[model samples]
Target: MTDLRQLRHFVAVAEHGHFARAAAAINLSQPALSRSIQALEANLGCNLFDRGARNITLTAHGQLVLEHARRLLAGSRALHNAVSQLGNLQAGELRLGAGPYPAARLIPIALGELARRYPKVRVQLLIEDWASLRRRLLNENIELFVADCRELRDDPLLSVEPLRVRPMLFFCRPGHPLLALAEPSAADIAAYSLAATQLPEDGARRLQETLGREPLPDIQCDNFMVLKELVRQSDVISFAPEDVLTSALVGGELATLPPREVLPRKGSAYGLVSRAGHSLSPAAQALRALIFAGDVVAQ
Candidate 1:
């Protein structure tokens, strides 16, 4: 029976400690504000205020009601704000995940655009391998993720939307021995240490077949930056999406190995992944649009 209006009146009176001043602050006449508070107290069967000769104070019951009223009002305001944000994309959060390659190559550009367009929308990005990202998405830790989705394409629990495919390339430091060979064989390249992030299942199988050995990087790292530095300083060869190697290649810090018959020139099958049948929030939708747009432009 008690309503928000009555609670507001009660809070105003409690905060001001004077009926006249509280009524003036709320643009209500003193008698009307008093009646509202009286009705609230009557509905709850308690005296919220103790009226004295010169000052008014909250009784024990009044203090308890004030705490509950503040919390309720705060929750109500948050609900209204969330509703408004859903319509306008003016404020909200986007929880996103990305595989190492997409995190390093694709996400930054899209996130930059998202930041410029919706400054109030908060973003939380988790960079991991595709399998880890899949777990996070299924657990509802992230609303969506961008990653190599070849393995997830047939997953009933996921919805995958393909992005522009990017060619993968192997690179080594400029003066590496592999670069000296006019045409390096898979065995020639594999003679030295290999470095990379976690490979997808198919990629691992192909590498194992090509090298005729175990498909494991001698120097495994999740971060490309670290892998790049390692390759630049050592005889380690590494592979990554072409875009991720652009800077190093352009600067001549690294050079790609000549395409070998044994090694396939496979491109990444990256996509946007989300839980099946789950709707994205407005902020997530906005970022998703930016990501798709950026992917098109990158092509």
Candidate 2:
């Protein structure tokens, strides 16, 4: 049997591509870390690392083992979280991941609802890109994620339920030059710099496809708040889901460009994505339900 500690060490080394750095990261002495890897490789009857001239690399066998190790580790974490929350949702932490847009709208509502229903449950939100969120979900870094379903739809290891299908809208600060025209052409919109928040490649690609040409983004940010502030203060235009702009629009700080027909009607659908075959904690379940309910009301 492989030791979880050794597997963790291996993952750290592989991630950093250097043993000394990995040792420092995991707070283990370099020699001790080396011995642990040696022990792991000996037990498995194969070398896990290729100690080459320039950079440390995973052997072919190490690559295969790394995948299995990650799955096993993730399963162990899920089991632990499930067991910890077996009782009433009185006290257990729920780690969640979400994209910038959904995080802005959904999390606060769900957190409030969850607090009302389960006051003792603690929650931590990890706002990240779709790729990082998926990786975290698989590795058990997050209990669940709410994000666009473009890539999650086909992933065999994960399960997703639709939350909302929202249309993309262009936004600019009130009295923006672009809004001066009744209808701005693609060229007209492209003339000014555009800003966007944390868009996945597929989402960006789809937007480009809709425009029939690539328009360079002058500013790309990971947080919707930052992007909103940039758009709110500057003449920069932004493209995002309607729900994401609700507060700003309602507050009269931002205005949508006219002629919605010019843009693509179909946009991304976001949802709850969790690892398949894993049991979610009671706290996670409650939060998921709240999210689903809130999404329905929003729709």
Candidate 3:
């Protein structure tokens, strides 16, 4: 029978590309590691490596077996972690992928509560633009996701649930002309230096039509903090979730563009999304519940 220990030795050698290195990695003597590999080859009735004096190369059969062995080892590890330990949230890694907007507030608040509860669970957050975040979800790099509904992408293996909605508002630095001056048309907004999301033309066509011009934001960015800071430092104007900059707005950080009767931009809804087919772990489920349940770390 092909022993699991021999297979581990074979995998270690294949991965390191050198028997001496692999032996050192696994804390086994080089000759013992070689013997383990030979035993494995005998069990399978085939030599696994072509040791060409300078380096080692795997035969076709060896390549195939190595791939399967790695997969089996990974599966075994996952199974052991899942079954052997239950509800010990702090022991494993939790990866959450979200666009910049939702991550701005959601990540800090959500993670704060998670830290208080599962202090040992390692949390990693990946922030990407709408386009990239969608790709990562499809690639299965992240288990949980959240983004604005306007850019809500649907894949057969993805499920989305509507979360909190924040109103979008246009604002500029405190003394910008847009505030004290008469209500200007979308054409007027285009005339000034504007900072906003780098949305594709087709996706934001209606917004463009309302603005009566191609959406040409002079300072295009996806980070709310950076965008808000630029507005504070410069006379730049921006349109974003009203709540995203609530602290900035209240603390003399930004001033809103007067509500316009001529052109009404509607509020946008942000949704909490996850990979459709994969089951979420308890830690992920708990965080998701807190997200929709409006549980946030009190500011």
Q: Whose TM-score is greatest here?
A: 2
- What TM-score number comes out for model 2? 0.82
Q: Which lDDT tens digits does candidate 2 get at residues 1-299? A: 67889889888898899988999999999999999999999999998888987688888999999888887776676676677777887776788998888888887898899999888777789998778899988777798998877767888999988877888788999999888897898778767787876565666675676566674455777688888888889999887889878888999999999767556537657879998987678888888889988988987
TM-score-better candidate, 1 vs 2: 2
Q: lDDT of all the models against the reference?
A: 0.84, 0.83, 0.72
Clash count (model 2, backbone only): 0
TM-score pick, better of 2 and 3: 2
**Model 1 Cα lDDT, one tens digit per residue, 55-145:** 7999999999988887676546445545756866787667789988888878999999989988887778998888899986765567799
Ranking the candidates on lDDT from highest down gives 1, 2, 3
Clashes by residue pair, model 1: none
Stretches > 4 Å off in candidate 3: 1-85, 200-203, 260-265, 295-299
Over 4 Å off in model 1, which ranges? 1-84, 260-262
What's the C-alpha lDDT at position 267 in model 2?
A: 66
